[model samples]
Target: MERQVSNRYRLIEPLGEGGMGVVWRAYDELLDRTVAIKEVRYTGVGDDKRADLNRRTIREARAAGRLDHPSVIVIHDVVEEDGRPWIVMQLIRSRSLAEVIREHGPLPVAQAALIGGRVLDALRAAHATGVLHRDVKPENVLLADDGRVVLTDFGIASLEAEAGLTATGGLVGTPAYMPPERLNGEPARPESDLWSLGATLYAAVEGVPPFKRDSWAATVAAVLRDLPGQPVRAGVLGPVIMGLLQRDPAARMSADEAAHLLRAAASEPAPYGYAAPPAPPPGPAGSWSDMTGPGERGPAGTVSLRARRRGWFLGVPAAVLAVAALGTGGWYVVTTSQSATTPTPAPTSTSTPAPSRATASPTATPEASTTPTTPRLPAGWRRLANSAGQFSIGIPQGWQAKKSPTRDSITVTGPGTPGMLLVEWTVPDKPVADPARAWVELEKEIQAKGEFAGYERIGIRSTTYLGRPAADWEFTRQRGGTLIHVINRGFRTADGRHYALYWDTTDARWDQDRHYFDQFVKTFRPE
Candidate 1:
């Protein structure tokens, strides 16, 4: 939008879209500078709730603003626009780690370890200040064009010693990258993040997350029960991945240990003629060695000058909050001493706990980069042809598809998932020639009814789908505990029947699960 918000930040162009909100490359009219503006378009909540969330967003921004580490993204200001909060931040021209993997394939082993180590440095600094970055995934890790591996999105972070906002028993975090304890709804410790870092590194080298599955529920089960498929590509770092991916949080590898392991695996020579520092002994002694400044060394080993100057990751894992529950939107995070509220989930299958899984068996075939750009069906997905011979679509195996004939739609539901895919068709009021405007009226209908709360129309635009004129509407809504992202696409066939496909995914799995919708569109055939 050319229209300015708060009389200062003017929207330039969308940099990215997510379940939370859209980030725009913006212009600051007052200062004549470029910045990134995040519009928090939360809808459906009451006035009081919105006000609380607004206050919390400001608090979170202030917390992040206090962090002066080089790897943390800087927050500039918080503004109120249209009764919602907007966060203005430093706009680093960068690509996410996820994007890098998608384009270049898996990184070389040493390079992956080095990146992971740098990220650990940032996390250590954040932990030192009592900030728990509750969400740590590849998407949150930014690889700046300038070689800066910055960690962004503390929107869902928990400040230690504060009341957590999440209701008891609610789940948080992206399931695939979450630690085992967090997946079971237990609190996440710093080691939990280390586990996520390990998973991220696993994906960095092996191409897919350690616990990926077709549905969120199964993914959660896998995280809790199954060991990640062994990684042949991990090479020297394979043992490190296994150490960090420990099923028991209490038994998980410490950040310093993991970092040291990464450094050893990195094996690149230090510019100042030193090797990676040894895993410090547990106590104040080793902690100081890690925090020592340029050219400092422990009594036994020499620390790198760069590591000393750059403040390398603390080998000792700091004890932070184990679990973070949100208040409304994830941006408003709260902390708890323990994350014991997660219900004990049933076993996934007959698989035993895989503490020694990587060493125990041969690696399974690795899944490719999970960026979800192509139309190919992932393994284990099934194709279903409509009984009426109208079309066929790919769906995750075991998901139940039910027809709602009166609504002219078919809905697919996973066993324990709230996400859904809906396909609907109806005879147009008359012979509709152009599909572009066919669904514009429906978009207007939704806009008028205020059907979406925190409703920001990402956009409603005309496009071509499979050589047929089509219109697509992308928008986000916040409903109670769930932040929902929706893609609604309408297609007009030559037979005068208008068909629409609607895909809904929760913010937690939005990036990972949206691919199925694409596969559906690719596989759809109009007969």
Candidate 2:
């Protein structure tokens, strides 16, 4: 491999490795200076995903390079060499706060407040620049040898106009330090960063994060449930930490309020009584917030609860968990929940070839409910035909039908539900492959990601559909204490291509949604 990059910077010794890429302390021969170069290499990613990674990398560099603050690391140059992005940044000699904690336990109250204050300054600058440091943790906090603090690693950061790589995919960022809503599939927000900052400071003061647990599932549960134990060691900074750690971003301490408190806490002496936050009443772990009005929509972060649930770096691809958002269709659809062991699926149903085109009525009539075999449509439902004319089906009223650009799929969505109907099909030049094993393969990958809670396979088996080989799978996902259910039916067509009809909805509404799902499946036509 070539060591010289951009025909100027020469690679020297390495600095560290992270999920996005590796940082190296290099020499910029052209500029006659030493610099930190971050190399983001997408090694075995598919073509479909490679473009996304490139976009995300360039966005990250641009986001970080725009910030002009002493506490924010300076970006010297950004060059694309070998189809990989190399970000040249200022070399800061320092130790991560994580190192400091491991070597000497938590910092003193004043010192922790001081460090947090400086980080807040960096955050303020980044926010002003329209940059969100999505991955803010102790390891990203650098304590320079010459008395300076800097925030590093804007890898998964989000900018004003750019959607995060994992925006619609699986959860991103460290679950342990991530805000609750993001874990529940919400978008990253400035307040979410604040919650992470609170978690970092809490660790600085208590040696352990307030919600540390033995496993990912347990950790997320703790974040959504337990309030941080009143910091016995936080002294004057205790209340400030709690305020920043508020579970709801809307109610969480504002940037100005938090900055003021941190500055004061840095100079204050230890105060006496520490008030414990009230333990939440046991019920559902997640609560609905920021209810949307008719046509207006909210950002993905509205699903957030207050707890600062953060996770470490997870190099995950675009995954479809709550629904069948993965793999174009075929069989990659699923829902999740927390379960100690995988449950055995019930017996398989007999095969039945469905009609190519069936009648669709725009009514939520419950014609057949005694048996799930003959599913009925919800009242006021209407028929939606794809613009490509590849297929058509009945959709519930208010549900929008969107034709994907590829002419191979359509997604039906509604405002009231978090689920959708996904249709995927392909014209094939080869023989059809087994459809049942596609779900099996998806299950393997989903389990391998291992970042889910309430991930339980409800059912799966081989079945015939529309005069072709077909398979069906159902599951539930309960992340951050909210339950979602998924149902997918995929089958091979005479042309060797596969088609799948996927549906997802909240678990609480599964019974109602399933009826709607049945009408669409029964009336689906592959023209």
lDDT of each: 0.58, 0.60
Write candidate 2's Cα lDDT for 281-372 as tens digits: 12211111222233434331100111112321112111113222343322333321111111122212232322222221212121211112
- Please write out the lDDT profile of model 1 over residues 432-497, one tens digit for every residue: 222333334444444565655665555554554544345565666776756887766664333222
TM-score of each: 0.51, 0.50
Best candidate (score: TM-score): 1
Task: Give per-candidate clash totals.
Answer: 16, 31
Q: Native-vs-model 1 lDDT? A: 0.58
lDDT of 2: 0.60
